[model samples]
Target: MARVLFVVFGGLAYLIFFATFLYLIAFVGDLPGVPRTVDHGPAGDRITAFIVDLGLIGLFGLQHTIMARQGFKRGWTAIVPKPVERSVYVLFASIALLILFAFWRPIPQPVWAVENPLAVSVIWGLFALGWLIVLSSTFLINHFELFGLKQVYQNLRGAAPSPPRFRQPFFYRLVRHPLYAGFIIAFWATPEMTLGHLLFSVGMTIYILIAIPYEERDLVGALGDDYASYRGRVGMLFPRLRRASPSTPPLEARDS
Candidate 1:
C-alpha cells in the first residue's frame, strides 16, 4: 500500500536524520574519526573558506526557513502528500547538514582555549548538557511528530493528525525556543573556540535570531491569541525570573 510505503520511507528518513544529528554532535565537538570538525581541517585560503562556509550555511538556512513557513507548506502539500511532506523536509535537511559536515573548511586557529582543567571540564559538561536539553525538549513536545515519524504513522492508521497546541511545559516554560537556547549553549560553551567554530556559531546564531521572528509570526498565526499571550509571559530564548501577573488569563487548554 502507498500508506505503508510512506511510513517505511518516513522511518528510513528518521534513521538518517538521527544519524546525522549524532554525527553533528561529534562534528561540533571534534570527537574522534569524524573527517571534518568545527576546527580540524587543513588550512586553506581565508576568503575562499569564508565564502564557501557561509554559502553552505546559507543554503541550509534557506531551505530550512522556507520549508517551515505555512505558505510554503500549503503549496507543497498540494503536490506532495501531506503525510510525507514532513519526511521530504527531513530528508532534505539531513542532506543539507551532511553537505555542510562533509565539505566544511575548518579555519583551525584558536580563538580561545581554556588552560584551567576545572574550567575546561565545566565547559565540556555544559556542551553535553546543551545537547541533552535539545534532545529532551523534543520529547517534551513530541519527538516522533517533530521528526516526521508520527505524521506518516497516523496517516497509515487512517487518523487525522491533531492540530498544533500552545504549550509551555518544562523547558517550554523557560523559553519560547529552548531548542535554540540549547544550540546556543552548545555552540558557545566549547573549551576550545577555533575560528571555524566561531564562524559556525556566529553564523548559526545569526540564523537563529533571524528565524525567531519569522517562526513566531507563524506560531501567532497558527496558535493565535494563545501564542501571543504566551509570548508576552515568556522570554524568547531565556527564562523569565518572575511569573506574569495573576490577573493574566491561563493559556488555552489542549492536549500536551
Candidate 2:
C-alpha cells in the first residue's frame, strides 16, 4: 500500500517537473551567456536567470521523482536505494526555493558565463553521448523493472529479488555505478563556465563522493560476499581495464 502510494505521488511529481522544464525552454528559448558576478542590466536579464535556475531546479526535482519511483517499485531496504538520497532531495528543495526567491527580488545575481564556444560544444556532445549510454543501459535493464517469471513470483511473495543480470553487459561492466558517472558527465557538460558554476559543481561532486561510499556500504551488506567480489573486480565510479578472471578463488567456495 505504501509502495503504491509512493509510486502514484512520484509519478505526479515527475510530470510536474517535466512540465515546468518544457514550459521554460519553450517560452524562454535558448539561454544567453551572462556575467558570473551580477546581472546589472534590464528586466530581461533577471528573467533569463530565473528561467535557467528554474530549469535546473526542475531537473533536480525530476531526478528525485524518478529515484523515489524506483525505490517504490523495487525495495527500499537498502540505504540510498535511489539515485539521490533523502538529504540530497531536501537540499535541492531548499536551494530551489532560495534561487526562486533571489530571482524574484532585485538581488545582485552573478550570472554564470560560458566562454570558448568550442569547449562548450565538446562538453555538450560528450554529455549527450553519456545520456545515450544511460538510456541504453536503462533499456537493457528492462526499464529498471524486475525480470524473469521466478522474480515476478518472488515479488508476489513480497520478496524483492536481486538486481537483474542485464546490468553487467550494459553499464555495470564499465563502472560500479554508471548512473552516477552519467550524472557527473552531464553536470560538467553544462555551458556555465563561470567560477560560481564551477564551485557549485565542485560542491556537488563532494556530495557525490560522500553519498557513493554510503551507497556502496549498503550494497555490500545487501548483496553480501558476491557484491564484495564484484567491488574488487570493478572500480567504484570509474571504468578500468580488467583481466577476465582474478587469481583469488570464489568467496562462497572458500566459505563452504
Candidate 3:
C-alpha cells in the first residue's frame, strides 16, 4: 500500500541520515579512514580551496534554512504528502552532507595544537560529551518525530498527527537551544585546531546565530505568549544563574 511504502521510505531515509551524521563526527574528529579532515587533503591553491569550501557550506546552510521555514513547508506539503515531507528534507540534507564530505578541501595548517597529554584527553572527553548531549536532547524532544519516523508511522496507521506542544525538558530548561549549544561545544573542543576545522566551526556558528532568530519567530507564532514568556526568562543559548520567578508557570503544563 502507499501508506506502507511511505513508512518504509521514511525509515530508510532516517537510517541513512543518522549514519551520515555519525560519519560526520568521525570525519570532523579525523578518527580514521577518511580521506579529508581539517588538516588532511590534497594540496592546492588556498584561495580556490577556501572559496570552494565556503560554497559547499553555504549550499548546505541554504538548503537547511529554506526547507525549515514555515512558508517553504506550507508550499512543499502542498505538493508532497505532509507525513513524508520531513523524510524528503532529511534525504536532501544527507545528500548535501555527503557532497560536502566528498569534496571538502582541507587546509592542513594548524591554528593551535595542544601538546599536553592530559589537556588533550580532557578536550577529547568534552568533544564526546558534546555529541552525547546532542543525541540525548533529540530523545528528550521526540527523536522519532524529529527524524520523521513518527509521522510516517502514524500516517500508515491512519492516525492524524498530534499538534505540536511546547516542552522544556532537562537540558532545555538550562538553555533554549541545547542542541545547538552541544554542536558549538563539539566543534570547538578539539585539542587540535586546523585552519580547515576553524573554517567549519566559524561557518556553522554563524549559521546557528543567524538561524536562531528565524526559529524563535516561528516558535512565537506557534506557541504565542507562552514562548514569549519563556524567551523573556530563559537565555537563548546559555543558562541563567538566577532561578525563574515563582509567578512563572511550570514549563511542562504550558502547551499551546
Candidate 4:
C-alpha cells in the first residue's frame, strides 16, 4: 500500500510537472490562447508591478536553490519519504511556477519589437529549439530519476537505490549544463521584448548564473574528481572553444 501510494505520487507529480512545463512555453512566448503571460497580465502601478514581479522571481529562485542544496535534501528527506523526495521537489517546483503564472503583473512597456519577418522567424526558431534541447537533455541523463519515477519503482520492487555514476552523454559533453543553456535561450529568444519580458529574462538568467556555482560545488563534493575534471574542461553554459588536451580524461558528469 505504501509502495503504491508512492508510485501514485511520483506519477502525478511527473504529470503535473510535464503540464506545467508546456504551459511555461506558452506563457513565456506570450502565445495566443493563454490567460496571462509575461507581458500581458493584470495591470497595476508600474512600481508595484515591478516590486511584485521581482518578488515572484526571487521567491522562485530561493525555493529552487535552497531546496536543491544537499543539506536541505538531507533534512527534507527526513520528513518526505526517501522514495518521494524527488517527486515532492518536482511538485513544489511546479506549484511555484503555477503561482508565478497566476499572480504575475505585467510591465507591458516595450523594450524592443522586431518587425522584420525573417528575423522574427529566426528568433522563434531558436525559441523552439531551446525548449527542445531542455526536454531532450533530461533524457540524456536519467529522466525518470531526475523527475522521481525511478525511485518509486525501486522502492516498489524493494530494491536498494542505484549507485551514482557520472555520465556526459551527448549534450553534457558540449556544455556543463545544457538544460540551463536551453532555458537561457528560450527566455531571451522572443520577437517582442517588453520590460516585463526583459525582467523575466534577466532575472532568470541571473538565477542560473548564481545557481551554477552552487550546483557545481555540490556536484564536485558528490562526484569529486570526475566532476572537477569535467568542470575544468567544459564551459558552464557555453561550448568550450578550446579543444581538450590529450591528457584530459573523457568527459564524465551528470545532473540530478
RMSD of 1: 1.5
Models ranked on lDDT? 4, 1, 3, 2
TM-score of each: 0.96, 0.53, 0.95, 0.96
Q: Global CA lDDT of candidate 2, please?
A: 0.48
RMSD, every candidate, angstroms: 1.5, 9.0, 2.0, 2.1
Worst 10 residues of 2 by lDDT: 34-43
Clashing pairs in 2: 37-110, 38-110
RMSD score of candidate 4 (Å): 2.1
Where's the lowest-lDDT run of ten residues in candidate 3? 247-256
Residue 92, candidate 4: Cα error in Å is 0.6
Off by over 4 Å in 2: 1-7, 14-120, 135-167, 190-192, 242-245, 249-256
lDDT of 3 by residue, 1-256 (tens): 9999999999999999998989888877877787766567677788878998899889988998999888999999999899999999999999999888888888877999999999999999999998999999899888999889999999999999978778888887778899999888998899989888899899988989999999899999888877888897798888999888888875554322
Tens-digit lDDT track of model 1 for 136-186: 989888899988999999999999998998777788977899988998899
Better of 3 and 4 by TM-score: 4
Task: In angstroms, give how far residue 108 of model 2 lies from its true place.
Answer: 10
List model 4 lDDT by residue over 112-183, tens digit each: 999999999999999999999999999998899999999999999999988767778889888989999999
Candidate-wise lDDT, in order: 0.90, 0.48, 0.88, 0.92
Candidate 2 global Cα RMSD? 9.0
Worst 10 contiguous positions by lDDT, candidate 4: 247-256
What TM-score number comes out for model 1?
0.96
